[model samples]
Target: MRADVGRVAEALVEALPQPYGRWSIAVFDDPTPNAFALPGGKIGVHAGMLAVVRTPDQLAAVIAHEIGHVLADHSNERLTQELAVQGGLMLVDLFADEPGIRRLAVVASSRDIDV
Candidate 1:
């Protein structure tokens, strides 16, 4: 974690409306301009984004935006939706005796997205 990012994470967590857990910031070496946050306070910022972001405030904006997604419970909603869909399919398989349905369920359950 970069010192600057560590500071930003601290400030952001402090500013957050509710209590948050330990957060980690990771700066990737890749050149693509991108950033995302995952559950449990894991934040990843692409190295390329640093070139265009220009200031700590801009970077903070990006971090805060990602954190907003976590705060909104988008990830949990998606997981619930996926599970419902997969469960339906698995139920159908129970009647049809299709082994492939279990494989599909595994794949679906493993799917995830960064916020």
Candidate 2:
């Protein structure tokens, strides 16, 4: 299993332009059909995913997709967005005691709005 993953990963890495991170792939014992790639080139594949993918090419495609996410920095971008949201919520909480602000927050919350 490791050999097959390595072969496909090598091919994909070779096709990319120079200066990608140092990659490492690990097979997890989990039953969920999932795989993920982290920043700095850590790839994880669950045993269930290996069972579901019928061929080497399919596995390569999955791995390549995860690698694309890492290369694009989607995780960091998502974290930044979440943090901004949390900060906004904190500001709302801090100002919740003021009459006008409290009224607005009450209305917003009644309407299922976080702000």
Candidate 3:
């Protein structure tokens, strides 16, 4: 099982256009058909997803898209946006006692988590 993971990781790395810093991959035993990539090239691919990807080339496509998300710094941007929204809400809560501000802040807070 570990050997299969290593092979997939190697193939995925080789397919990338350039080296990604500290690249690593893990295969989860979970049956969820999902994969994700984090900053600094860490990735997780569920065994269920391996079953869904019938070919090495297909797997490479999936991994490449996930890596692209990481390379583009989407995760960090999302985090920064979330923090800013939270900070704004805190300020609104502390300084303004208006009902409309509370409602507006609630709406903003709800949408912010989607980032």
For TM-score, the strongest prediction is 2
Q: List per-prediction Cα lDDT, in the order shown.
A: 0.77, 0.77, 0.76
Per-residue alpha-carbon lDDT of model 1 for 12-111, expressed as tens digits? 9899878877777889998998887777778888888877787889878888887876777767877787778777886777787877877776676555
Candidate 3 wrong stretches, greater than 4 Å: 1-5, 15-18, 84-115
What lDDT, from 0 to 1, does candidate 2 have? 0.77
The residue-by-residue lDDT of candidate 2 on 38-85, one tens digit each, is 789888999989989989989998998888877887668657765665
Superior candidate under TM-score, 1 versus 2:
2
Give all TM-scores, in the order shown.
0.65, 0.71, 0.63
Candidate 3 local lDDT, residue 83: 81
Q: Which stretches of candidate 2 lie over 4 Å from their true place?
A: 88-115
- Please give the range of 10 consecutive residues that has the lowest summed lDDT in model 1: 106-115
| Per-residue lDDT of model 3, residues 1-115, tens digit only | 4345567677767877888777888889989888887888888888988888877767777777777768888678768876877888789888988879877766766554333
